[model samples]
Target chain A: QQPVQSPQAVILREGEDAVINCSSSKALYSVHWYRQKHGEAPVFLMILLKGGEQKGHDKISASFNEKKQQSSLYLTASQLSYSGTYFCPRRRNLEGSTLGRLYFGRGTQLTVWP
Target chain B: EPEVTQTPSHQVTQMGQEVILRCVPISNHLYFYWYRQILGQKVEFLVSFYNNEISEKSEIFDDQFSVERPDGSNFTLKIRSTKLEDSAMYFCASSRQGYTEAFFGQGTRLTVV
Candidate 1:
């Protein structure tokens, strides 16, 4: 099943902050975040595999709450390069096996303006 | 850094014609996948290939669609008879293992008119 992402679209000035949320109906084994620029392929951002795991790189960070079946991505002091669609892809445990197939959310379109 | 490479960044074909999109995944990756994204829509997984066989596929990957790894470095997705709806950006990705992060190709934009 596809996960649901909130704030379908957001516009921000450079150096601002934004939060994108993803929620799933099923238990997720991991949540992977990606950023896709216009006319380009999605780029890997970060992956959260454990509950309460908070991973940060530069000004971007994410949190996964397995108990809530939700994950949130945080972008602080956003840069113009951050303008793109943010996607959260997740996998579920299937009969003790990870399907390895990632179902992606609809995506949050973030536009950072100068 | 190694990256997945796709050919013919853009292709325009008449409806009902055959089309094949190619990809060369990272040399050491063990898992390969194909995904598609219609303009302004979410990316959807089409199929996952491993060990020269399909591990899993979505309903979108019907009989008309087939995948092949004919050589050590080439992976291909062939569409027998294309339809206008098949027009989309197709991306190829590969990962070293099932649960790791996958790297995606720049994507082949297929335009079936």
Candidate 2:
């Protein structure tokens, strides 16, 4: 099933923080995050595996709660460049080859203001 | 720093025409995927290919759509009969192995009239 992303849209001021959550109905092995600017391909951010593992890119971090079948992306001290749509993809059993392809969420749009 | 590359950034075709979108995934990647996003809509997965065969495909990937790995460096998505609804930004992605973090290409914008 497609994961559900919270806050269909958000407006943030520079230097603020925001959290985007992706929740799935089924158990998930990992959560992959990506940010896409207008008319551009989505850029990889980080991947959080099961067991509550967390990963990030510099200040953009994410957390995965395996028990809840959910993941959260945290943007700390948000910059203008952070403005984009965020999506999370879920997959089962991060063990072998199947770990690459992901089932994606609809995505959350974030707009940063000066 | 290798990235997925796609050709013909934008294409226009009339209904019933055939359109082929091309992509070259990262050299070391083993899994290839095709996804599409209509303007103002969410990205949807079309199919995933590995070992010269499809590993998985979504319902949206129907008889009208086909994929091929013509050579060592190229993967292609062919739409046999174009419909207005087929207009979208088609993205190609690849991962080092199956079920891993995917890297996407710039995308080919296909406009079917």
Interface RMSD of each: 2.6, 1.9
**Residue-level lDDT tens digits of model 2 in A1-114:** 778999878999999999998899987777888999999999988877666798877789989898888889999999999999999876654577553556766689999999
Q: How displaced is residue B104 in candidate 1, in Å? A: 0.8
The clash numbers for all candidates, in the given order, read 0, 8
- Per-residue lDDT of A110 in model 2: 99
Which 10-residue span in candidate 2 chain B carries the lowest summed lDDT? B93-102
lDDT of 1: 0.91
Q: Give the CA lDDT, 0 to 100, for residue B9 in model 1.
A: 98
Q: What's each prediction's TM-score? A: 0.95, 0.95
Off by over 4 Å in 2: A97-100
DockQ scores of all models, one per candidate: 0.57, 0.63
Write candidate 1's Cα lDDT for B1-113 as tens digits.
99999997999999999999999999999889999999988889999998889999999999999999999999999999999999999999998888888899999999999
Q: For candidate 2, what is the DockQ-based docking class? A: medium
C-alpha DockQ for predicted model 1: 0.57
